[model samples]
Target: MDFSTPIMIIGLVAVMLALRVPVGFTLLISGTLGFAMSRGLDSTLQTLGARFYDIGSGYSLSAVPLFLLMGHMAIASGVTDDMFKAARTFVGHIKGSLVLATTFAAVGFAACSGSTTSTTAIFGKVALPEMMRVGVDRRLAAGCIATVGTLAGMIPPSVVLLVYGIIAQESIPRLFIAGIVPGLLTALAFGIMIYVRVMRKPELAPALPPSTRAEKIDAVKSVWAAILLAFIVIGGIYLGVFTPTEAGAMGAAGAFLIALFRGRVTIDAMKNVFIETSKTTSVIFIIMVGALIFTSYLAVSGTSGAVSAWIVGLEVNPGVLVILYLVFMLILGLFIDPISVMFLTVPIFLPPLVRLGLDPIWIGILVTKSLEIGLITPPIGLNAFVLKSVSPGFSFKEIYGGIWWFLQVELIVLAILFSFPELTTWLPDLMYGG
Candidate 1:
């Protein structure tokens, strides 16, 4: 097959993306056209007929909607608010405590939700006002909220990591297990950054009055539902007591119970949650189907293999090659959504890296971390946009200004993960035992 065929298809995808066409449709059109070109219209038509059902019926993919439902239910139950309150109550006495609380709350919410936008939007509404009220610098408050939301990409039940596992054909449970340490470390790094920043510039954030022991205890008690739900969902998976799908189901049910017990589960609220879940799930499946179709075309046309062989023939150092691919993703991430970045690059770059005997699991984590940085990067920072939408007063300059500090911390964490593959791999290896 002529290399031009795949090149033309890629160009078409780029053009469509530049035109702001939806990612799902871009992949669908490009894949269908490319497949038809190489395999004939009849063969392409047959595959299209089967593709939807084949992807839609995937048992593993069912977990996507279930986990999404759990996240939406958690939002409806005011879990995000409780998490922020609890963290603030415990640590409010410290300098930059509100900023610290926001980070802690984000980590807690990440345990429950996988959608970064959802996390950003909720925290923007819930935490931003509180931080502003406490005289925290608007830029710092907004920046921290925007940056921490990316945690959902690395944390357990993360839809991004789940999609990565599906596309890369790695173990989902292992991916989830692998994310735990890096995710926490990222949060810790953010906490440290916040502490140092507030210490150096005291006006950026004001310390809240310390809570009494009883108040702290009460705050902790208030979030018992969130703690229990996270334990049952994440803890169950860690202990091997539940499959990812079963865990998603239990988490969704647990979230609903939390809402129901809290009297937050009105009929209308339930309807809205289900509708939102269906919408998100549908978009994800379309992208997945389209990506699979596109990758199938690459396979049939020998593009993936050809590219892999070409890269291997170069005999470059494996470390440099990995860094190059990561740098490419970081740049692409500046323009595209994280999901699109994964769908576009993984099929092309992952093959050569895997051929080099690098671990796909570790690569998955690194790719995820790169994409997480993209969410807060300049020009097209999606999380920053989300935060701005929720917060009309903060200009892009202020948001990006605050983001710069946390971005440094993120880069440091990314470097650490890259330098020590074991940081990303050890837990999974220990949990599943290589």
Candidate 2:
């Protein structure tokens, strides 16, 4: 339970993770070992067993698989392509419109899919080429897809937010609502950046011819499924007819029917859907368990409380404290996954922030918004790498270069959200009459 003990455990976990020990097992084994060393094997085993049950039996964890299922069904149903087609029809011909359209489409898709990489990969394949063909700036085009992809967390049914809500014991519905304004603001911010980039250098995003009246109507009609789906899921939740978990279930059910009606659902496809869902779900569960173990280790070593004590001891303004905290996460994100960052740090950080009078739900949005900055950050940019793998022609350097503007825009949005909690909190409050 000494300070040195937590430091040692942290070091061990980092080494194991860096060695590519499966993240789930690395954190689990490392934390278990740390606990055993500090508390004796019998007590450590008891702690581990208790922690496992506590984490597994959590009501909020139930949201993970159901939401994952929702996203998987949405993807398997071929709804993403339809969503993108509708987005392109409306915005494709505008100046840098396809890139902006991809941004627009991603926000809408993320509301349904709730996977950053899903939106990223979907747009990477569907919109990237079209932008390139129209002479869009490669940097801007790739960066737009890479950054916009992160909307999955900012939108409802967000896997990351679900995990955060579960761990923090916050309202998933409130978290969903808290994310809406910031999410839309983020999308709009990206759109504006694209608009400015295109106008400053017109060649970067040349305008497409306007769509015909019939074409515009068809675009609107094609997206009716996604529209109805979003309304049912988000609107229902906002109206309090559904909890986050129930809404996720309903979303999955709706996605399945839509897929079936479209004739895309076959027995084989269903099997694959379940198989894929299990694989993804297993990864999430294991990490959840591992993070549980890690969190326990931090508690046993008293590191969680110590970090907070140290932070609160700082003699700086609270606003500066907020900026410093985000900077710390941004740096850690350079080498860690967002979930890992969330699990490892939240116990220590959030407690102190709340003790300082910050709103937990608003801070939740701020945490995710900060982590989004890390998505395109180097050395550990997961979204950027997702694009790199699919892009045979684009350079990682170029992608990284373009990401600066996206990162800049997101940082500005983060600042706005930090200063004005209403941007992230008003909708949820209004919906609940808080």
Number of the top-ranking candidate, with lDDT as the measure: 1
Once model 1 is optimally superposed onto the true structure by TM-score, how far is the C-alpha of residue 357 displaced, in angstroms?
1.0
**How much is 185 displaced in model 1, in angstroms?**
0.5
Who wins the TM-score comparison? 1
Summarize candidate 2's per-residue lDDT along 1-434 as a digit string, tens digits: 44777788889988987797877888888888888888899988888788779767867677677778888888888777777777878887766678888888888889888777767877788788888988888898888888998888788878888777877888888888889889999999988888888888888888888888898888887678877998899988888899887888899899898888889899998998789778987887888788888887787677887888887887867667777778888887666667777887787788887778778898888888788778788766888988988886899888888888899899899889998988887788888545
Q: Please give, for residues 127-198, the per-residue lDDT of candidate 1 as tens digits.
A: 999998889998899899999999999999999988888888898989998999999999999999899989
What is the model-wide C-alpha lDDT for candidate 2?
A: 0.82
Off by over 4 Å in 1: 432-434
TM-score of each: 0.98, 0.95
Candidate 1 worst ten-residue window by lDDT? 425-434
Q: Which stretches of candidate 2 lie above 4 Å from their native place?
A: none
Q: Supply candidate 2's per-residue lDDT for 198.
A: 85
